[model samples]
Target: MPRQFPKLNFSEVDENVRLLAEKVFAKVLREEDSKDALSLFTVPEDCPIGQKEAKERELQKELAEQQSVETAKRKKSFKMIRSQSLSLQIPTQEWKAPSVNPVLSPATPVLPSAFLPVQVPYDVPEFQRVSISGDYCAGVTVDDYEQAAKSLVKALLIREKYSRLAYHRFPRTTSQYLCSMRDEKWKVEDEVYPDFHSPPEENEDPYNLDDAPDNLDYVIKIKGGIPFVYDNKEMMELNEPRSLPYPDLETYTLDLSHVLALIADGPTKTYCHRRLNFLESKFSLHEMLNEMSEFKELKSNPHRDFYNVRKVDTHIHAAACMNQKHLLRFIKHTYQTEPHRIVAEKKGKKMTLKQVFESLHMDPYDLTVDSLDVHAGRQTFHRFDKFNSKYNPVGASELRDLYLKTENYIGGEYFARMVKEVACELEESKYQYTEPRLSIYGRSPDEWQNLAKWFIKHKVYSPNMRWIIQVPRIYDIFRSKNILPSFGKMLENIFVPLFEATINPKEHKELHLFLKYVTGFDSVDDESKHSGHMFSDKSLNPDLWTSEKNPPYSYYLYYMYVNIMLLNNLRRERGMCTFLFRPHCGEAGSITHLVSAFLTADNISHGLLLKKSPVLQYLYYLAQIPIAMSPLSNNSLFLEYSKNPLREFLHKGLHVSLSTDDPMQFHYTKEALMEEYAIAAQVWKLSTCDLCEIARNSVLQSGLSDKEKQKFLGVNYCKEGPEGNDIRKTNVAQIRMAFRYETLCNELSFLADAMKTEQISALSK
Candidate 1:
């Protein structure tokens, strides 16, 4: 029999737990001052009396445990098991890649498995392994250990549920352990991954619309914020919607509250804090001992190194995809060649490129990277408003609209040309890819159709680029201007058209074609802005949210997750590509934002706030959720480069990759992605193996199709551990891979053991 988990109902939860969640929400809202908010999320510099007392008490408890004979015996046993169970070795046989057809509708094509057995050319040299021979629960009490493990496992289950519902990727290694803890068998067929359409072949036309599936004519309605699909208008009138799995708001809130309460739990925090420290120390020991051996292994591998490894710029904005210098050059060249070409209209008067510059009292010839004023500086630090203004060239919004926006008098021709130039450079590099975000403000239903028309008209499709749709969280601004009636309208305008296009592709051919290259969605805005509203079951639904006040970050994430979940289920049935909710989270916000993202996002960008919450950080590590970090971007907006946590997170075994958030503002080179890597490698003193490993993480986190990933990373890239790594292709050392794999397994084994102990205790009772 399959294991069944208990259902969560908000009303049935303990009152104390409910109050704790409320307290967390209230605390986040109350922290309006930047300094106070920062302190609330980060470790306080001035240790309070309560914290000091707690530390003293913990030290006394540790001293007492050191003197206990039973504790000593338990420690010995743990050491013996640790050494015997975790002895690392190279595999003699290659594992075959599993056929992962995540969505199996009749219209879906089954692609063949890309895996093929290949012998490793060089053996991974024997290296020192860090084995903890002492009590695994040395830092915390056994009771505390059990509590942390239970809470963590519960959190993973919550994430896995959401991931599978949306066809998101969850690590197979973690899934197997989860299955074992539940006393069930884990099968490859149970794994679900997001389906991304492969790029058109060289002989095929990217703009061909004849291949769209026949129209199903399904009816879609957004009653509140969630979409319901009906077979036809008759089914809709009868209120008989399709049998797609829709998320329940109450259940989601209950699960969210559970995670919220766990973050504040004393025992769990203590356990997680200790484990994170241990992970960092373990990596240090491994590096000191196996550093040379890992390098030696890399030295023997031929035709691959850090420079040649495929790296994806997983987080970048389309508006600022090019560097400031590139933008300046493009502007000058346009003025030099097409000065008489009509490019814009003001007050219904057509204006040429030269005339627009003349109206601004400037000449394109005089514009240098410095005079452009697009680059961010010290003044922009902690000032999102200032950073946003940097999007405009020379403090002029006219230039931005004419050059950066997708809709303009010239139909974004100038912007498309710049983007294509960037893409051409990437093609020349042959080892880089990017997922640039284009804005979809959800102001009207025509936004989708217009954007699709712009895409097709400009012929902006690039093999080295995958597009992401970013929804700016500016509902309050729109509501204030009376541009939107309610939040529900906004949600409808954003998603309803996509649902229609999916259900009737022939009628929406342009959108249907354009969506093939879009791989994910991103929620982006200034996270530091405070919204006093607390999201709960009692809060107003989207349709009734008529006030000018904006909802909180959690509110936005939950709704986005819901729509994406339902949309993915609908598309899966039609054999269509799905979207991943890769939100811009934890950049600079309340810790609660990270909590919401943990359950909703497939991965997140700029997770600097994780450093403050050890519990969430450990959970992120356990789940192996990929994070795209941009230190230069942070330096100009939130944190300093020297204080960035990317290096620390990397050392602690987090799935982190380097990204250039906005090359125009934060970078100074034509090869923006390479500039990002070079700076990170130099500042962090990263090794070749470290750089390659990060590059490998980027490919896995990106929206590239499975066929492309296999060609780049290796056929068995889907597998975990050293077996998954192909050094000849990835340039990552197997020794490093083995250490990472063993460490994760060791941590997971502890959780599995704790669950077993709980089961045994229940049986005894």
Candidate 2:
């Protein structure tokens, strides 16, 4: 049975808790508009007065806690548990891969070891381990430690609830610990995973529309931005929708408030901050002791290496998938080959490719990479507005429309050709894969069908490329132009067609086929821009939000998440592919954006803002949520290359992968994903194991199917720890995998111990 989350009531929430959430939101909003934008990306520093005062308060509190006899007894008990946990050895499991033929006839000859299944050794080669003993809670009072542990656990539970509700992923290890805390048995069947469609076979048709499931008599209506499914028109009239679990807005806001308040809690902040520091230091010590052993292990592995390990560019835009040189050459080649061919229409006059460039007072033959002016530079740094303009070639929107858009007069032929060319390069690379985001603006209902036709007409299917529908958060622009009457209408335009297609695929064959290759949705836009409205239960529903002012970030995430959740449930019931919400978050603006994403996003891109809040960062680490970082893209628009926290986050055991956000604007080479890895390796002095580990992470974080992952990583790729890692396939050291697994288990053990103490205290009471 699927786990059901308890519905929350807004009125039941304490006023003080609500006030605290409001304060947190306001603080982050002010920070977003502050001149010290760099501070958001770096660790905040306290002034001398505040630092002294904080230290004095902490010291006084510690002294008082030490004098309490009950506190002393609790501290001693905690120390004992910590010491015992530290001394206990991690359980080892021997994984022997099953033979190709389990029952072989006596006449059959034995297969060679190479031909046998790949087996991962659970008994990792012995290496030095870091152990700390005595007074584990020395730095903080036992009471404070327990408080932080309980709060962190509560936050994790909240996230788990959301992940399960939306069919997003939760770490198996963390889920097990959480189950133990609740005294409930965790089962493999309880695990919920998003369903992604696998690619078609070589002999099969990629664009086949005949295999769509039979239509059902389902009615979908978008009311206040939430999709309601009814059995038929009579049920719709009766207001009795099907019993699919729809999220309650009040409950969501209440959950959001809990996380918001957690980030502001003083004790939790200190605990998480210290733990993060310890993690970083612990990694440093582990490296010093076992660096060579890890390298030796990797060296002995056969065939696999950093270059050959499968890596996916998890975050990139379709329009800029091609680099400046590629785009420039394509433009010139089109002009040289088809100067008289009609490519666009403007002012009711058909125009040739040559005429389009001539209108802009330019000739394609004279164009160079520099003159194309699509590449980002120093001027673009910290200036997203200027960086966006770089999308237009030679400072002409006409050229952008002619070559980049999918709805042009020529049915996006030129744009499709360019994207296919980029796809060809990725196919040739063989080891590289990319999930490029294509736009889905909610200005009209026909947008989905148009995009689908464009895809089929161009035969744009690529085995190496998966698609993500990126909905740009520009409702204000549309609303201002009267393109949309209200936010509810926009939501309907975006999601209704998808629901319609899911119900009646025979009528929407093109869209149903296009959606198979699309594995997820992305909420994208400039994060630096701020909206004055704060999202709350009292906030206007989407139907009432007719103002030109854009809804706040939280509002957008919530509505998007709810719609996707319902959509996934519907699709899952029909045995179809489900989409993950991988939004762009934490790149800029308020740190609260990360909070919203914690409950809503499956994984996020550009989590640079995680550096600002230790509590949120620790939560992200515990959940093992994947973050796709694009440093080169950041260097051009937001943070400097050296200041990026990808290295720090990676060292701290955060699940992170490298990606090229925009190859056209930020890259010089044809291989943009490789360029990202090469620079990181050079700058950070990363080891071969580190690069392979990152590559392995990219594959895991991608939308690739389970079958594909098994081929790339191993058959048992879903298992946790060293048992899951196939050193032969991944080229990652078993020693490193064991260390990571042990460290995480150690952290979870502390939380579990805290819960046990709470149970005992309640029993005593």
Per-model TM values vs. the true structure: 0.92, 0.95
Candidate 1: minimum summed lDDT over ten consecutive residues — where?
Answer: 103-112
lDDT (CA) per prediction: 0.85, 0.86
Candidate with top lDDT is 2
Superposed by TM-score, candidate 1 places the C-alpha of residue 256 at a distance from the truth, in angstroms, of 0.6
Instruction: State model 1's lDDT.
Output: 0.85
**How far does residue 740 in candidate 1 sit from its true spot (Å)?**
0.5
